[model samples]
Target: MVKLIALYRHPEDQESFDKHYEQVHTPLVEKMPGLKKLEVTRIQGAPMGGEAKYYLEAAMYFADRAALDAAMSSPEGKASAKDLMGFAGSLVTMMIGEVSREG
Candidate 1:
């Protein structure tokens, strides 16, 4: 399996970001051809009880790397990417990796 991990930093306006993410961005992500699952988490604090480095995390799961690549080149994927860059380009960091082991 392969996945794209997105780590979002604290936005200038949390309410607006949350609203747009839930209403708009999420739907766009759901349209991708090879998307198996989308898991999102809101980061609250570090283990030591202070602020965490990231505000949120999103994991987009795919069947494999080829599926991931195909999804990235799809029209739906292009739209989603545009939306992401329009809204959170500066505040988000994304990475792609394979799952070596999972339960």
Candidate 2:
């Protein structure tokens, strides 16, 4: 399996970002092929107790890299790309994501 993790650095007004993610982004990605599971989390607390970095994190599970690539290249994928700009306009940083998983 492959797990894609996206680190979202959001605007200070998190409610707006969360709303966009739920109402717009999440659904677009959820339709991608090969996705076996999906999860989204709002980051909270700094274990190091300095500054909390990152606003939210999302994970998408795929059966394999090929499957993931197909999804990322599909119509849903194109829409996902367009949707990103909505939050990215307000974001400090947005990470593409790293994929990993255990068999």
Candidate 3:
């Protein structure tokens, strides 16, 4: 499996960010083709208990890198990309990786 991951930095307005994410961004992402699964996490604090650097983490699962690329090239993906740039472009870090689900 392959995964597209996004690490979101703390935004200036947390509430507004959350609202747009849940209401608009999520739906746009869900429309992506070849999406196997989507996992979103709200980061609370570090192991030492101060605070985590990132505010949220989103992982989008795909069958492989090809599927991921195809999905990202689709219309839905284009819309999501534009919306992302409008909102969290500067505050987000994104990566693609191969997944190993073995123990």
Candidate 4:
């Protein structure tokens, strides 16, 4: 499976960011092709220094790298990606990567 990890920093106004995400970003990402599952989480606590490093995070799961790649190549993906700019101030870091295991 492959997952796109989107780490959003604390928004200038967190309330607005949460509202907008539910009203806009979530729906937009949900409509993208090859989206197996979509999860949004609020970051809390410290992964390492007893302090939280991020404000929000999202995990978009895909069937595999090919599906994820195809999604990124599609019109919806392209548009949704561009829409990310709308939340520029609320974004800290975003990354997409793959994971697999041998048995």
Estimate the Cα RMSD of every predicted model relative to the unseen true structure. 0.6, 2.7, 1.0, 2.6
Q: Compared with the true structure, what per-residue lDDT tens digits does model 1 show for residues 1-103?
A: 9999999999999999999999999999999998999999999899999999999999999999999999999999999999999999999999998999988
Compute each candidate's TM-score over C-alphas: 0.97, 0.81, 0.97, 0.85
Q: Is candidate 3 or candidate 4 better by lDDT?
A: 3
Q: Sorted on lDDT, highest at the top, how do the candidates line up?
A: 1, 3, 4, 2
lDDT of every predicted structure (CA atoms): 0.97, 0.74, 0.96, 0.81
TM-score of 4: 0.85
Question: Sort by TM-score, best first: what order?
Answer: 1, 3, 4, 2
The all-Cα superposition gives candidate 4 an RMSD in Å to the true structure of: 2.6
Best by lDDT: 1
Local accuracy of candidate 2 as per-residue lDDT tens digits, 1-103: 7767777774777687778888888899888877888887877868987556777777787777788788889998778867887566556343434455354
RMSD of 1: 0.6
C-alpha lDDT of candidate 1 relative to the true structure: 0.97
Off by over 4 Å in 2: 89-103
Give residue 96's error in model 1 in angstroms. Answer: 0.4
lDDT for each residue of candidate 3 in 12-98, tens digit (9 for 90 to 100): 999999999999999999999999999999999999999899999999999999999999999999999999999999999999989
